[model samples]
Target: MKFKAQLHNNTVLYRIAQSLAKLGKTAVVQLSQEFIKFIYLGESEASFQLFAPIYMKNIFVDYNIQSAHDNTIYMEFQVDNLIKVLKSAQGNETIAVRLLRKQKKPYLTFKISGYSRSGRTVLIVQDIPVRVLTPVQMSHIREPVVPQAQVNILLPPINNLRSVAERIKSVGQCITISASNTGKIKFHVASEIVDIEVFYRDLINPILPNTKEFESDQIYQNHLERYFSCTISTKNFVKFLYAHYIVPASISCVLIENHAIIFTVYVTTTAIGAHFEDQGNACGALTYYIPAFAL
Candidate 1:
């Protein structure tokens, strides 16, 4: 197997690592010719899953992956370690990722090149050990599949939502979110003595894309007057906000009534100095979905 990618936007990759670091400790990196996926599946008490995939053209200028396992490779590593090394980069640095093996053990290495303050060139190499997944192990992992969402409302700025969620966390263990085709989203928290609410009105309700998962009959065209709501743990909601540490190109709220809440983050992947890539057809790059029952 061979894997390598030249980083076109180092900040995007670093923020991804940071987002994953807050949700779970380990993730499966799926490397294919078309995409690089950072996936986290629920086990034990996790009750949540993260699916983040970058379009090959957006981040990797020079990308290659070859494997006998149908041209894809899967590896598991510690998210904290990945974030620690990535934090060493100072925004001006250039970073590249590759795979290597030693003594039958695999490692994912980052090669960072930068200039020092003293007018000197410096290259930093950081290697984190990883567990390569066999074909059998890979077959058992799958992304979560959900039915069509009842409401998909374009969200207010994530930072504003995060700030509200954090403050509401003190009033209750769970936060209730209500959204509708009315172009409004309201978050409510209730305690014995206090009931607090934050509302974002007049926001746009983006046109839902036509996909197999959402058939023509399943769209929310008739529900413009109704509100779909779900309650999830405030702690988990706050953690999900970490994904927006960097401003998103687009972020939307998706609710399946009493079932789940899915936050789709379309990262701002405009390559520095380049025009904004048309992401109209691209699926949400990062999906953070939490089941209501899990909390």
Candidate 2:
């Protein structure tokens, strides 16, 4: 079995590895003709999945997979080790990765080549045993009922969010996020002695799908302008904010009452000189699901 690919954007690869490392040490990577995916889980049973569609031009110079019978290749590797190697990338370098099976052992070789006069570096990492996880059926999970009270608001830049979270994290074990239909979102934390609320106003509220369903519900309609709040662990929430180093084009917050608060990060590779204006241009999405804390 042989698999190789040339990655056009080293920064994107580095960022993805770094983000995954923050969630878990190991991840299952799937390489096929259609897309490349990295899957892992975090706290609160939250799962993080990264997808790089093969259809994107300039993303992958060459993706070849040759196996005995199957066209897909599944492998497991330490995310932190990969991130350490990828950290050496100077943002403009191209990454080449090749997988080989030697003596019944899998090895991954990474080559980082700089664009300027800087020389190239090659590193070979021997992969541990691959453990394939059984795929979970989405239909098995209970879908949050429609007309559920949810507030969709655009998040501030990642750096800003992280900085704010760092300050308020120490004050409370969990952070409360509250949103109102009047175009306002608040990050609040309250202790026995003190209370803190950071308000972000004048932000655009994304149009939720099936608005008519929510409108017909009297409970949600009456409190439509009232604040809807959800609490999530401070530690886990801070970790999710660290993905800002990847410089996602946009991050949106969706708070579902009695459900989960989901952050959808649209990842685009700036190393390729491509500006992602909308979801259509995004190479992948890094979504963080933080289950709501019981009130």
Candidate 3:
């Protein structure tokens, strides 16, 4: 998202209207008020005020604005070609000098009509400050944070076992062991394997502990041990899942007002024949609740 800052022109216009309404029958106010009627194409009188430095007194007295719509006011004035001089003034300073110098800028006009003890009053107008959009800017955004931990698991020999090994190599850590009855196959990834290593070394675990490939005694569980660690960065981890067929699960919840929840959990597809009542299978979601030990 982006942000833009500009003057609340509508509020400034309202102030101008209020100032004119206080002018009563003053000739200067009356003339500006009269000019406003023609510009606004309406008959309405409103009070307005214009405050500026003493040096700018004449500017406010002679300057005028007309309403273009329910929320817009405009002015017309001329300025020298020096944009630097024009950009220095802020808010009132900008409007004051622009009007007094008759800089080539826009003006505001308002429609006004009223009747006082003296007689009819019309075109009550005043000049107010405003701003416009100039340039666009861009900024960088920070990514989200992710907590991490380590887990060791026995992997199954899927079709893309080699691909999985390569992924683990990128992380620089991981250990996988595939056991079967026909023979025993052990695997260990000492470090993350990158594309360059494919030329010097095999991507797959060429040796498992003592076995070169598959051994019948080691297939079921002949004590084939391997150690590997993976340093998973958040970005790479997310990309890995994106490349693989394995999609993470998702859960969504909506809650209103106060609510409470206790333990909750999930069991993976490869989980041993476990019961849902086990602590490892329970997790919790709550709208609001205090911890049991908080007291």
Candidate 4:
């Protein structure tokens, strides 16, 4: 079995590793002919699973995969170790990865080459013991329903969000995100000593699939105009906010009352606009889900 590939964008590859490392110490990487997937599950039940998929043709300049026994290859490694090697790569460097078996053990060799110098690092494959909750089981476990109140809002600049979140996170255990169809959103944190609310107005509210249905119903229409609030762990939400630096494209937030809020960062190698439906080929995405809490 032999697998080798070369990626053109070292920054994007490093960002992918950084996103996975934010969730857990280890990451499960599954490579196929079409795409590469990185999966990471947090240590806590309330923590969300980080799923990043990068299309082969979109990210890689040269690729080859040949398995003697299987069509797909799966391996696990320390995210920090992989990240350490990836950090050594300069912005202009090309990343080369090779998977080979030695003495019945699998190993991954990573090489970073630039115009002047190059470095190589080899890591032994390790097994990830963590088991992530599947989407089916997650729905069952959470008993999530179609949110009575939902908001699809365009996110503000990542640096602004990160700065506010960092300040507010120190004051509260959780942050409350409130949104309305009036194009207003608020991030609030309240504790025994201080209460702070950061407001952003005139934001675009993207039309969701059920927007028409909600518009026709008087009850849903009324609910849409009213502020819908969801609380999530401040620490976890801050981690999600930090991923903005890794994603060069636009980011969007979808909030579902008493259910889950998802932060999706559009990733693509092409110049095409960001669309939620785009997947694989020239486009891929990374999504971070934060479960809502009722207090």
Candidate 5:
């Protein structure tokens, strides 16, 4: 087995690791000729899941992966350490990630190269130990599936939403998120003595393409005025906000009404434009599935 890839976008690589570090210390990585996946396969006791796959064509100028095991390699490594090393990378540096065997142990190494202030070339190598996962170990892991979203709306800047959500977290245990196909969304919190709500109007309510799985009444096209609301743990919701550090070009939410909220955080720039429905998913997206809080 052999794997070595050069990542030109250091910022994206750093952001991906930072977000995963929020939930746990380690994460699973899958590498193939097509794309490299950075996954956070939520804990058994929790329902949060993250799937971040970056195609080599988009982010890597140099890509190589050769494995007798179906041309793919799966490994798990410490995300906390990965983020700490990535933090040292500067804007001008290129990170070459590779899988290495040292002293009979597996390791994921990041060799960063760039020029220093004195015009001399600088090299920094960060070796992160990893455990190569076998086929059986990763067999059952998969992305979550839910019913077609009832309302799909583009979110405001995550920094703004995160700030508000963090404050609300101090006074509430759960937050009720309500949305409609009419370009409106509301975040409401209530207690025995307080009821507070933050509302946004005239937001972009993207027209979701008709899917065969969507029922006649559940489709947003026909129910523009209907609202779908779900209450989710305030803590978990705030944790999801940390992804804003990646500086997403845009963030969109698919509300399944009382079921789950799937956020599509676009890592690529200009994800959705004039032809939003056509171009919204043209590039890779970081998929986050946060289950609704059960009463």
Candidate 6:
């Protein structure tokens, strides 16, 4: 009368186990994606009776409890095997019934021995839901919101610095890059950084008008960014690039705002006095153009 289910990945299965030790009648159970049907007959002949199927198909009649503590029956049907049998023999009752009764295939073996009033019975089942994991492999997820005015972007590499830079450049935007003190590098984007973030959100969380469901990562990388730009304070920008890109701490201060983002990186061999190298470590600036469109 009572059931519990276990789910892993896309597969799910449920079982109704017996609690009382005294009852020993064999239980018969049938299950499908939509429902589970159980039967508890007083005799083997009654279990195989003509009305068994009809009673099962509409068995949610009335019950004080889904399963009485000491009077409930349980069934475990082999889900896959049952589906195969049912689908292949939709109208072939003789073969289906024979297989159900004779074959010892791995299946939902019903264990139906419950004590109930002479004319009273119980049945219980529920629908199980399944969810598929999104198959997205994108590295960055975008956030919504954009600014109306121009925004400056200062980016330092966290990992794979060059690869990240290359991806951004591929957006066909012009980017100005330069070496700075220690081992830091910087990039600048001209568009409002907020707008870029909004674009990224759309790319990462695409909406489908038809199904009203988010699109699966399986479809395609609809809008991967070839480039990005961020604005950072000079000091933090140095740390950001160093920590993320694995660049040394000596590099600092990239000037990254104009018509394009520019970096005047002062690469230094030593941490000390690196920020104040020859004439205050003012390296030549590198400029890159920002792309007009989002990936």
Best by TM-score: 5
Give the winner by lDDT: 5
Q: Write the per-residue lDDT of candidate 4 for residues 1-295, one digit (tens) a residue.
A: 5678876766666777776777777876767788787766666555676667777777676788766434566666787877777666556345677775555666676665555434553322222122322334433233123454378877777778888987887898888899887678899999988999999998878754365565467776676678887888888788787676564445778888667788777776643325544533336677777887545
**What lDDT does the true structure give each of the candidates?**
0.76, 0.66, 0.24, 0.68, 0.79, 0.26
lDDT of 2 by residue, 114-162 (tens): 5544564544443434443222432233322333546887776778888
Q: Candidate 2: deviation at residue 9, Å?
A: 1.6
Prediction 6 TM-score vs. true: 0.18
What is the lDDT, from 0 to 100, of the residue 67 in candidate 3? 31
User: What is residue 153's positional error in candidate 4, in angstroms?
Assistant: 1.2
The candidate, 3 or 5, that scores higher on TM-score is: 5
Cα lDDT, model 1, residue 61: 76
The window of 10 residues in a row where model 6 has the poorest summed lDDT is: 12-21
Native-to-model Cα distance after best TM-score fit, residue 241 in candidate 3, in Å = 49
How many residue pairs clash in all the candidates, one count each?
Answer: 0, 0, 55, 0, 0, 36
Of candidates 5 and 4, the better by lDDT: 5
Model with the higher lDDT, candidate 3 or 6? 6
Q: Write the per-residue lDDT of candidate 1 for residues 96-215, one digit (tens) a residue.
A: 888988678888888888898896988999899999898898776666567778788877777787788767878988888898877888898899998998988898777543455444
- Each prediction's TM-score against the native? 0.84, 0.78, 0.15, 0.78, 0.87, 0.18
Please give, for residues 1-295, the per-residue lDDT of candidate 5 as tens digits. 9988887766667767777888778899888888778888666624788888776666666788898888899999898878877788756567898889999999988898889889999889989999999888888888876888888998877888987886788777889999988889999988887888999888898765455645775564556777789888887788788787667656788999889898877665232211234444444667888889877
Residue 42 error, candidate 3, Å = 38
